[model samples]
Target: MKNCSNFTNDVVYSIIISFISVSCIYGQIPVENDTIEDIEDFDIIDMESTLVEEKKDSISWVSDVFSAMRLGIQYGFTYKAEKPDKIMNNRFSFRLEYSKSFLEYLSVHIDTKMFTFLKNDHRIRDEEDIVALEGRTREAYLQTSFNKTSIKAGIQIVVWGESDYAIVTNEIGRLDYREPLSLNMDDLRIGQPMLTIDQYSSFGYWSAFFVPYSEFNEQPRKGTGYYYDPFDGKVEYLKEKQKGNFSEYGLRWRKTFGKSDISIMAASLIDNQYALRMVNPDLITKSKQRFFMTGVTFNRAINNLLVKGEVAIKSEKAYNDASFQIVKKNALDASLGVDYSPNSTFTLSIEAVNYHIMDWSDQIQGIPRNNYIALLALSKQLMKNNLSLSWASMYNGPYTNFFNVLSASYNWNDHITLNFDALIPIVDDARSGFYPYRDQKQVAFRVLYQL
Candidate 1:
């Protein structure tokens, strides 16, 4: 069975590679209606009449092919924040996008990223830069209308919550935490394949999703400081077929009335939050496991301030035992956040969250029964909207640990921009989340050109 699964995976990957290679070589283009060589086969007057009708409603595929495309390039580098050393992330990347409307009811969007990274260090390079070049389809989806309902198919991104900087109700997509707290939530999500259906009415909107597969979070490499390897290097990965039953399915209902918006959502998905989890008494899991999450969220504008709140209960999550086996448990989390933009150039926001474990035992040593996290964010724009500065900090109240970041960006022009960011951590206990990343303080800069 294992051999067969490996063969199937290899074939799928090989087919994908071949498809990309052929596409790059051929550069297939849409056909123009007026460029047909066999014009004698059709009446010229009828063709002209059809063209006129198309101009009134439908768009010419030839002219619409690349009309909505955007392409750009960026270069970035990163180093230790406090102590300058050799660059850890030396990157040059290409960003591409193409979108077009086939009809009033149908549309398509494509986004892709290709990048390379280089590291020359002995220890770090072995684990990270082993594969310096990578490419992936960020989003390639087709959306169409079915009566009053709209459906989207293919690989795409879906964010399902209101609060920022923390995960309360937004647990759908696979998150990439390779750099941990160095990056924000927006940059940490990875697209996945799903079928989404949305329907809107005077009362509210309803959404449903059927996801065929699930994925684990992309964590730091084994040699990295934040890598979670309780077994040092001994771990086992379950066969792909063994995980075939872990399909993800979800539903959400949202409503807006007056100045307030509310939603309720539920999903059966894998718990990808934990990077290292034990699967059995003798084995540890190399990927995420099954879990269920149900939550409610709300947001409202109260005069000058906007408030958002979420409460989620997750079940079937695994907790490690002293003997190394994992035990399934339930956890509940509640959070509230409020944001205020006193003026056009400045904004302030604060969030508070509390988590409780329904099933607590002595084997869960590092985790507390009742834990809390507090967060604050501030941003300001200067120089007439060209220069911007922002700072965000998150405090783990139970452990007295903090994660802070400060960023500055300047838009040189409509076509060029520059960004600088720093990540700093404060840890007082070894069990804190930031303790693993304490030595990972880093500074990064990027220059981007919009094409």
Candidate 2:
């Protein structure tokens, strides 16, 4: 165990050293005259309309390389109704990225991120805390051409599909259930080296990514056997064992026709022995465990009306003695909303979505066999873009009646902002208890600074 920990640390340290060395070497490269002039005359709004011209201008290795030096800090306080407790947490995150023009036809990019927890609070468990840092990244690699095509290697993130507030991909953050709140902090999956190809055309854009198998350092392990007690139905614990490797690959395509856009994506994972045993015991003896998913999204705008929707299907092979059984699950989600702009200072928009998860066989028990959700949101801007107020309500069918959220934000400047979030429960049911939160109400206040 100690050896494994040491080896993990060694790998992390080596990655950090390499990142620093490359960043320093590239940081010393002098900016050229034409590059400086081009950046100065660059217009962000105009570039959006000219796809080909924008792509050519945006492909600057020097500007992207230097833009990698960034720092950020966040702090927040929370109050929960059930516990009647107050907790605070803070975080500081930094990244250094470097890009260089190896030749007119090729460019290299590297990025590294380091994070630190600044404050601790017990009401929020470490596992549920959004400010916690699991580890530091050593390097992220990207090799791109002047054209739209590029291949990236090293630790990085790839996002596909389109869901308003949530995504179905593996790159999802852990939810904080202690306070019955979900706060995503962009700290989900670690950076994995991947190869990607991207193309840009007048119609739209397309990208594809492939990631080799790798194990998550923070993934939990289960003990050998389960124990049953008279009072407690069943108890499980962690056991020390050899970890395994896993790899994921995906393909995505998108096209735009006038005001309407469409996208389709598919992804699959291949897990090795140890991981297979932990996630699917039925597949342990089969050499590899597989998980597959496919999704589609469509967004269209007619006049002042905008509509968007997504649907997905996921399947996984059982792990137990019935390893041959492949359980299939389906999810259907769709949202329709419209934005109304009455003058420039006042704007109002409303949207609603329905999420449904199909039930598997009776054998798969604990999970909800079927579920549905609906949401409504409203927003207003005050004093231009400096201040804003918003409210959202979510109803989770049958179980919990509804959840409500109210938020307000004040932008002190371009680099600093303050915000508040509150969660309220509108209905309560015994069988449909709150799945994400325990209490009826919770509130949080946060401050963020970017550099």
Candidate 3:
């Protein structure tokens, strides 16, 4: 993606693109009403009446065309607590989506997003500038359905697993880690291009996917508040490029029984997280290793309580030693969560996660052999469900790191919404990833309008 600093033009361009693309792709829009008249009893008055009806029909068609398309726009900003006058993020975003069914068994969908970063400052590095105009096609796909089977191709988002807060098996889609602590959970995923086949049978629902060109996680740019500096001194960094092969595939089978759901999945893929390879004390390179992973997830609802868990085993995972040398080891990841909802307006969720490296070694550079994390979330709605309030907290067991977020959202009406979020990070150990921005507490405000 290319970045430009023209904010007004970018916003106008996004609006024009949405309308033009939708009109062009649809070509002929179907109208529901048909005006009929009698020719034998026609006169000048009847002719004028018929012409007026035709004009109304034309207006109705245009209205229907515009109403059928989905459009949304959002503007938000974050303010740092330490530097009250400084703005951390000022973003304006637009989204457009259009879907159509061409045949009984074939359909297509297009979703696009545009973002304009209105903040320009020193924190935004020149090497990888984050403050500018950017756009992406969130999803553009064609699908065919036959009886109990369906096939889809194009850019898409796939979600797998049952645990919340901790990612155990939902590794198929890449995640955005650029502003890890500030982003909402629902907006953290980035779409990937792939072909998928899903089949429904008496046994279960089977799904298989092939990603020809898989992508890695979106990391923070250098000089950003969230960027992590591994080495203190200057070091040369290099990334190894894959020559010709770029493929990742996975299979999943899910079944439902009463109020319970279970799924098992396996994949051969390159890790999204990179490992450092030390060329020397002053040189280090970021690289990813291929690995095999298999996992299972299940969720069951009982009374007012819901329980979910996931466990995965990965072979030949990549890691860095104390000397920054690369090492391969097996690892196990597991997470369990429980939700208690006493009423429709209030809910609480608690989760625990663990990551263990087999063939343990104390020489691991950043991660401990056994890492544990605890999470808690509570949410409530009031004002006839127009106002929502939530609080989420996370704690690292070994590092004594603590992170918390408080959020509130209010619906002004059917088309407008206002949101506010506060993020707080307490770093007890310098080894913790959150230590880099220990003093960067922030409060964010957002307004969204649907068109």
Pick by lDDT: 1 or 3, better one: 3
- The superposed Cα distance between candidate 2 and the true structure at residue 44, in angstroms, equals 45
Best by TM-score: 3
Candidate 3, after superposition: displacement of residue 82 in Å? Answer: 2.3
Ranking by lDDT: 3, 1, 2
- Say which candidate scores most in lDDT: 3
Q: Candidate 1: which stretches are off by over 4 Å?
A: 1-63, 119-124, 127-131, 223-228, 234-244, 273-283
What is the alpha-carbon lDDT of model 2 when measured against the actual structure? 0.55
Q: Per-residue alpha-carbon lDDT of model 2 for 1-451, expressed as tens digits?
A: 6467557755765675556445544544436664533443343223333543443454554356557555556666655555654443344546555656666766666556665554454322344454445345644675766566666666666655444454444321122122234423244334556677787877568777776654443322121011112224242223334357556777777898889888887777543222222234222222445566677777787665566666666565333223333344554445555555655555455555554555545654333555566667677888777899888777776576777888999999989989898877766564454532445366778887877
RMSD of each: 12.1, 14.8, 9.7
TM-score of each: 0.80, 0.63, 0.85
List ranges where model 3 is wrong by over 4 Å.
1-64, 83-85, 120-131
lDDT of each: 0.77, 0.55, 0.81
TM-score of decoy 2:
0.63
